[model samples]
Target: MILSRLSIINFKNIAQADLSFSPNINCFLGNNGMGKTNLLDAIYYLSFCKSYSHIADSQIIRHDEDFFMLQGYYDNNGNEEEVYCGMKKRQKKQFKRNKKEYGRLSDHIGFIPLVMVSPSDSDLILGGSDERRRFLDLVISQFDKNYLDTLIRYNKALAQRNALLKQEIKDAALYEIWEEQMSVTGEEIFKQRKSFLSTFIPVFQEFYTYISGGNESVGLSYRSHHEHGELFAQLAEVRERDRILGYTTRGSHKDELEMTLGEYPMKRIGSQGQNKTFLIALKLAQFDFLNRNGFTSPILLLDDIFDKLDSQRMERIISLVSEERFGQIFITDTNREYLDEIIRKTGHDFHLYQVIQGNIESLKEEK
Candidate 1:
């Protein structure tokens, strides 16, 4: 799938902007704080219905603006689609497709698949388990709509059960009802997550080998609070403990995806370079999986990918991209020299845009 055009108004530092995009490669080049990243973030928001850089939708609105609007036209899996997002500083954001409002965010989820590789990817190795869990959940949610529905229902049940636990319930019978509901939803979540990992792990194994030149053996495992075969039974056993703790404790909500390298945990054993490579490989693996599954390959967003890589590593990555194997790519960098080199070597058709202080302009090839 390809994003043919994007329009942004009052988003971050960008007061208003519209840019036509190429199907293959689109480069956003500028110095620091020039809003190059914001352009990519806008496209991402249109696709995902949220921002990658910030949690609050209000923060995406430019200063003094009451709201922000972003829209895009995409050729999604051979279907032409239009999507729009509008957010107010004090109200919830709204999403629409084909000019009709989407009643639930889940209705719009995964309509456009995306794979973002930002500088903060080191969090996969160094950050807490929640980060990795979130990565897995979001990616899997895109691939499995039923998984997304189950996840949403499970989270709602969990929240309500936690709130009930904190209440002064005189009757123990009420507690039983909530417990039964929570256990049912939680078990479904656990099962879906385990099934997802069963499919995802082999893909990772293959791509990790491809990206690492067959030298490093990479692996991923799912860690859950319940035993592999006893998810429901474990939740039942934890009822008393959960009641005392005022929250449900054992289920997919507390699961993790652990990354390892050659029998050693990557968090401790992998170098910074290795971590970055692994994250990139993980994204590439996702791309391949999506392509094979008949979903459009995600729009690949690379932010400052060249900053942490040597020329050789950068060349390898560029070679893979230039193989004309992926979908729309939006990449950002401070210097255009490296990109120029890749263009010369690969001869791929790409549009170069110069960004400065929230403004963008297409640059002509130097004669």
Candidate 2:
């Protein structure tokens, strides 16, 4: 799948904008704080039914604006369809496909696949476990609707179980009910994550080899809080402590994806460049996985990533895009000269857009 057009109104810094995209590689080149990343965030919102940057939908609306709207046209398996989303403060966010309302956010999920490479993604390696967990959950949630439903139900059950634990109810039998539900849901989550990693690890390794020149062995290991062999029994053993803490403390949420370089933690041992490359490699692998499956080819969003790399690594990334490895990428920079330099060396199909304040203008078209 590919986006053919995008329309934004009173969103972020953009007051009102509409632009057509090149089906091959549409590039957005502009300086920082010019709403470059915000533009890509709008596209992401349409695909995932939420903003990529903000936790709340109201944050996307322009200052003093009552509401905001984003619409995208996509070519899905040779059939054209339109996805529209509208957000307002103190009101519900609405989503529609082909002018018909969607009943659930899940209905619109994964209709369009996307892989984003932001400067903040380096956190996936160096940051806390929650960050890595989010990385895994977002990717898996998109491809598997069942996983999404299970995840939602698991979280709800976990919350209710925790709330009950905090209360003064003397019903010791209630703890058994929570444990059984937690075991079932947590086990499903663990199994799906393991299955996904089985597919993901090889792809990640191959990418790391390519990007790192095969110098070091890159590894990803899933480490759970409880032994998979003893998961149920362990949950039973820890029930007392969990109730004292007022939470389900030993489940999938406590599991982690460990990133290692050679024999050391990538976060501690890898250099800045290595960390950035690893992050990019992981995202590329995600793109490849989605592409290999029947899912849509993701539009690569590189948000000020050039600023975080050296010329060598920058060229490496440019080569990947130049080789047409990623479909329809949007890149941002603080200076036009940076993009101009790469554009000078690489002869590829793309368009340049000049962004200032909330306005955007395309410079040239593919000939």
Candidate 3:
């Protein structure tokens, strides 16, 4: 799917914008905080129905504005599609396809499969285990309906179990209720996660090698209590202990994706450059994983990620992203040097714009 045109109003710093795009590469140039990322976020909002920065919808509306709107015109396999989103102060955001509102946001997950690489991704390596689990869940949920549905059920069960623990409910039967749901759904979630990693890790390694020129090594190991015992049995065993802690302690909620650099923890051994490279490769591999699945050529967003890398890796990334398989890329950069290189390398249709204080104007275009 390709976003041929995007219309925005009162979203983030972008007061309003209606811009056409090159199906190949659409580049935005601006200094920090001039709304380049916000423009990309508008596109991201249409894709995921939420901000990538994880802020409240109320925060998204422009100051002094009571409502915000976003609409995207897409070309999918020669068919045209329209996606619209609107939010009013103190009201739920509405997302629609072809002018019809969605019954559930989950139904929109895979429709416009997208992968974004930004500086915030550093949290995947530096933040807690929950960050890594979120990475896993986001990728898998985009491609597998069963996995997404099972994850929703498992989280619901976990929340009920935790509430019971908080209340100090000692009835094993009461605990057994939610545990039954968690055991059935949790086991399915863990299996899907394990299966995803089994296929995902190798592709990630291949991307890391290509990006780093094979100068460094990386690994991702999945750790789950599911491997230790059946989820129900594990929950029963940990029940008494969890009662003391006041939260459910044994389930897929405790899962982790340990990232390693050359057999050592990435957080301990990775320098700033290596960390950025690792994350970029990880996300590109995610794009590859999604594109190969049912989603055809998922949109790719690169947001000011060229900093702190040597020329070799930068050129390698430029060469890699210019390949034919990747499609409909949106790139944001603080300067033109790297964007110029990418435009030169790809030799495809492109439109470049300058963003200033929520205003966007076309600087150049070629087709």
Best by TM-score: 3
Rank ordering of all candidates by lDDT, starting from the highest: 3, 2, 1
Q: After superposition, how far is residue 7 of candidate 3 from its true place, in Å?
A: 0.6
Off by over 4 Å in 1: 77-79, 168-172, 365-367
Q: Is candidate 1 or candidate 2 better by TM-score?
A: 2
Q: In model 2, state the lDDT of residue 196.
A: 90
Ranking by TM-score: 3, 2, 1
Candidate 3 runs further than 4 Å off: none
Error of 1 at 169 (Å): 3.9
Which pairs, if any, clash in model 2?
Answer: none
For model 1, how does the per-residue alpha-carbon lDDT over 8-112 read when each residue is reduced to its tens digit?
A: 899999998888888877888899899988888888788678888656887788999899999899887678888988988788888999889998988777878
In terms of lDDT, the poorest run of 10 residues in model 1 is 168-177
lDDT against the true structure, each candidate: 0.79, 0.80, 0.93
